[model samples]
Target: MLQGNTKILLLSLLVFLLIHPSAYSQENSGTIEGTVQNSSGESLPGVHISIPDLELGTVTNANGQFRLTIASPGTYLLRISMVGFEEKTDSISVASGQTITLDIELSPLVFQSDELVVTASRRSQLIGKVSVSMNTISPEELTSRNITSLDQALEYVPGVQVHGNSVNIRGSSGFSYGVGSRVLLLVDGVPLMGPDDGGMDFDGLPLIQTRQIEILKSPGSALYGGGALGGVVNIITKDFSDEPENTVRLYGGGYEPVRFETWRAGWGGGSDFRPRGGIIFGRSHQVTDSFGYWFSGKIHNNSGYLQNSTRKGFETYAKFGWDISEVMNLSMYTGLRRNNNEQFLYWDGLDDVLSPGSINLTGNEASGANDGLSDRLTILPVFQHSINPNIQYTLKGRLFGVAFRPLKDNGHISPPKRHNKGLRYGLEAESTIQATDEMIISGGLSFDENVINSDVFVGEDSLTVRNQPEGALFLQSEYTWNDQLTTTAGVRYDAYQVHTRSTATQFSPKFSASYSINESLTARASFGRGFRVPSVAERFVNNNDFFPLESNITLKPETSTGYEAGVTYISPILDAFSLKAELTSFWNEYRRLVEPTFVNELAAFQFVNVTRARIRGAEASFSVSTLDQNHQIKLGYTYLNTTDRELNQPLLYRSKHLLNGSANSVITDWMEAGIDFRAASPPERVDTDFSLFVPDAEVFPTQYITDIRFKFQVPHVYEGLDVNASFLINNLFDYYYVERPAIFAPPRNFQIVIEALF
Candidate 1:
């Protein structure tokens, strides 16, 4: 054994000598020092501090002090982890013989359960610092929603509007062909958009794959760049952690309105000095009604339920991390998804209303469902490093491609191949600087390029065009004015060059001021300006002749000004129960709006810049939690109301009010259960053509839905191995209501999920 070891060592030395000048040609390195503290100024010891994906790590001493040594003069990622405190990461720059000091403030982990996030600026900064309203859906929350697509998970969030796979924020609606474009979706800071039109297929994103979903409810243009005119949706995936034994999850359920089954599996392992990688594969079988409010065009409780439409999908994602050294790290992630869907249409009514005798519709005849298929592939490569502590930087790039094909027979027995294909590429770089104990600065630049192709030509001459670019620059600064006050401000400049003719530029500014009234109460106010450009669908529909955004050089970008003020009060005196509540009111004015118009003479619709609208609303969330460590009970609620000044009515497809509540408790030493309920007011549809005098439809109201879940440890199983099962019943009481003009909600049905982990 000794002889063999000596031979191996000799070979390793020979290889090293072949690659370098000498083994002892030494190089100098530097170290970093830091301390951790909570809001109360108490030192937090045992905190894990290290450069992510690096071979170096250390723990905080009893006084919350840490030291790290590295051999590089570049940026590195510094991550601080603790059991009861939130995880914080920053980029740091290291110089030879230089010692950097960084003192960190971390919120308690309790907030993680509440789904709070701070990635809007490529760094760790809470939404409270921004003027916009934001909401976060934690992993726990995602599990509660129990749906596979982002479209279903965001339905309960306030100010977030969803119709099927389409999403819009605030009162910005009706931008793309019956869809909305006021929102941008991202995953791990990578833009999740198709290359051609800057929009995404919501269903193509898997909800179960994400560790967190941050929903910013205000125009994020000032930070997220263009297309953020409505808002931003950031999906953060799971981080690199200690290798797990294994994990498997399965779910199956079906009803007259909807049916679905899903399965997922993952594995991970590697040496201590080198980081590991993992891959996950998920497949699901889904089916819905022929026509309904969501999933399909057929109503749930009517004749369409018996003739359910079908949808099946597949998703696969992978992640790999490498530990180059203590000061540098690299990671790669990718995901692929495909969906096949069918939407059944009823032709009997249409045939009678139009060409009465054109076709025979009497005896249970069917025209078949429209066949639609969508596919997406996303690839991201990320590199980060922390030189020392005070400064760090990151480089991330993403390439996304999507294809959508719509096929229909129209009873003509022959249908041409019609589809849309798009591809998008994006890159970003961010730098964080801690100049002083009281100030921190962050800056970043983002660029996106899209290429789109549609079967039908657009414009006056019916021509096809491809390739467009959008870019932005953003910077944010946070300053602490003693212990009583803190202030944050940011600005972003976005530029969009149309395929032809003209370009639009916007400069958005945001500011927020907060005053700490003791340790348990705080007051804050924020203001900002926002703007958005038209979507590709609105600019050039498949079968319509519409001018590109550039041709209409005179068209103004949609703009808004907003203001909000709120106060948070927390108390822990009531029977060890904590009570926290916040109330905020906002008013915004929008201008140079775009709306779809009917070109009756041409037999198709066209997008035109026409009217302006003003919207105002208030929102509040209050929660009372009984702090029992192992068992807890909580109640929460939210309310909102928005109006469109031009139409003298409420905004379309938006709920006027919302309320949510839940309770959680430990059933045993290794078992737990939770129940949740939700309620929302009605929504309204906007009229697209005033000349026709067509009145908008009022969506029917809905009652609350209650859901339950349970988790238990399996006896005689591996440590930490447990099973989780949940039963969700939508329309808990069988409430009959319409979410759209003519579509009805699904009747009461139950869904079940089972998960096992070690």
Candidate 2:
């Protein structure tokens, strides 16, 4: 049933037959100019000057200049990245009216090898040609910690562990409350979930108009097929700054008021310490010579330190670009978010931690819990054509929708519920083929469709409309077998259907390798296969919140296989320091894993496909920097060893030691300072049958969290303005932890951010 104007006339005839009527004629073009600096010679503004074989690039302003204007004219290779420098490449030559000038320097890199990713091959490359274990997140780590949730900027990355949007990478996810999601979320590479709890709405993204966020831990269903069975993040946005611009940001904060008055009198009181704020607005322009646009919007409110945990929201993002010739290029993206929240779910025990109850499933205890509002929207359209420049062709389309409304106590307007909607639409067609500069190839073909109108997925066929459909086919390749080897391989084929059931298929395969033997050593390896299916609220939920869920329309589909190996080393030591080190080892294996049991003759709870697991791990990271590169320090560690090969032991909420640390310094020329640390090591097992529905399922010890920040860069605050200010502290020294098991994880907080740029 394809209506809606026949799916907008089949996506406008597939972007007008993938636009290409031959167009490429920039007369005799040629030009290049630069001024990047940084080996003690300062300058360096936003660096990144490129020419990855004519893909062109730019960035370097605010006095560090840069310009490129080449439409054609031979010989290239002109890199030069930034993010702590050291990545230069040069080898130029142009003819036909030239205009070259240069002066690039760089040097002060400590293992940041010129990132240019695309979520590990949905295109772009270089991040040392990725072979597993990737992470990137940087947009000043969410505006210097004034972070408005992207899971609090992934709770400080290293081997991730976030508790509310449930992520666990490397330990490979544990909580399965939001239905089915083994990490897979992308925007700017399409794929978005939660069309009825396939989870990952992480506040429905737009994280400060993000510009980079890659993640990609491992096992990505080959070229991304099912819910990526644990891996993939990819949210890359932010663009359109070729001149005209405007931006403004404002922030505020609170929380830091519980000095143990018996935990503020056990929070029997509602709403204490209410504060938190936000504001943002932006714009970018350019309207001719091939269009351009960019936009951002934000509005947040929090009032949450407990009691029904308040929250408010509004998010927005927009992007547009066009240049239909020179071999096409078109992009469009838009997102919107709306939220109202106020419904703390897991408390009321642990000595009434900010009160809100739930511990049902006959273990008894329940209390008012309902306050919500959500509305989300997204649209994406992309096009690229270039059947030149070593082959390229992409055509994507998407339209996502969401709705939720629950509110029935206080501030009333309506109640007794029924307004949950979700819809997903899609299309994809990708291809990249540099098919022979030592093999490049990539492939894609996708389709998706989902619809839901939930009652938490009423099942027993009391269904209130639900549909799911999916399709995929992927291919990948990357070969470089030289200059110290490189390799990659892939495959994917998926199929789905969930309403008139009976059609589920899977196949994903992968292999990877990277070797570099010298040049500061490198070695990597990977193997993968992944799958997941089951999520219409885990196969038709029949909700009761706190527990009493039941629906398992033949549930079954979860598979995984992953393995990794790594080694890295970078050096520079005594010439005034810069070093990097990495070591990794991972192993994963899961099969039919889906929990939420207790089906005593259907007396309740059910989303079965019970356990079979394995999760061996080892991770490490280290870094140091200095050499005109301000200062830096990093540390990472992870060690897990889960096993539940049919209840053998360990693997319930899995987390066996994880740590992360950081330090930054650049205390002058407009200030900077930082510190962060995180630790975890709890939940070795919490399944007393899922704690009979979690009422102080208590298993919280060994977790220390701290964070700190400060920054200022208020220079010439007006003309073409730029201003910045920051100060942050998060749970710093207020670690009364609980990352899982009764929910209490936030106590110390502070913030202040002000930014302006024009």
Task: Tell me, by lDDT, which candidate is best.
Answer: 2
Over 4 Å off, model 1: 1-32, 35-116, 126-132, 168-179, 196-200, 204-209, 257-308, 344-369, 408-417, 544-556, 629-641, 669-673, 688-699, 702-720
What global local distance difference test value does model 2 have?
0.77
Q: Count the backbone clashes (under 3 Å) in each candidate.
A: 26, 1
lDDT of 2 at 512: 89
Weakest 10 consecutive residues of candidate 2 by summed lDDT: 16-25
Task: Give a tens-digit lDDT track for model 1, residues 1-758.
Answer: 99999999999887555323123333577678878876655565445677865667765543455666676656898888654356888999888777788989877744322223555545544333333466777667666546566776776665555654457565555323333355777778776755554565565454444667888766666777665666788887765433433445555554332221110011011001111111222322112211111011111111223122446656666666665676677777777777655553221121111101111122322232355667788788888876544556789898888877764434232233356777788889987655443556778898888777775535443556566688889898877655457687999888887657778899999887877676566788777777767655556554411111222224456777767777766656546666667677776677766655555564444566665676667767766665654555544444545565776776555666666666677778777777766676665544544213212223246656666666655543666665666656555665555444333344555556666655
| Predicted candidate 2 versus true structure: per-residue lDDT over 518-636, tens digit per residue | 77777889899988887888888776655677777898788889989898877788788878788999999998888777777866768888889999888998878885668888899
- All candidates' lDDT scores? 0.58, 0.77
lDDT of 1 at 191: 68
RMSD of candidates 1 onward, in order: 14.1, 23.6
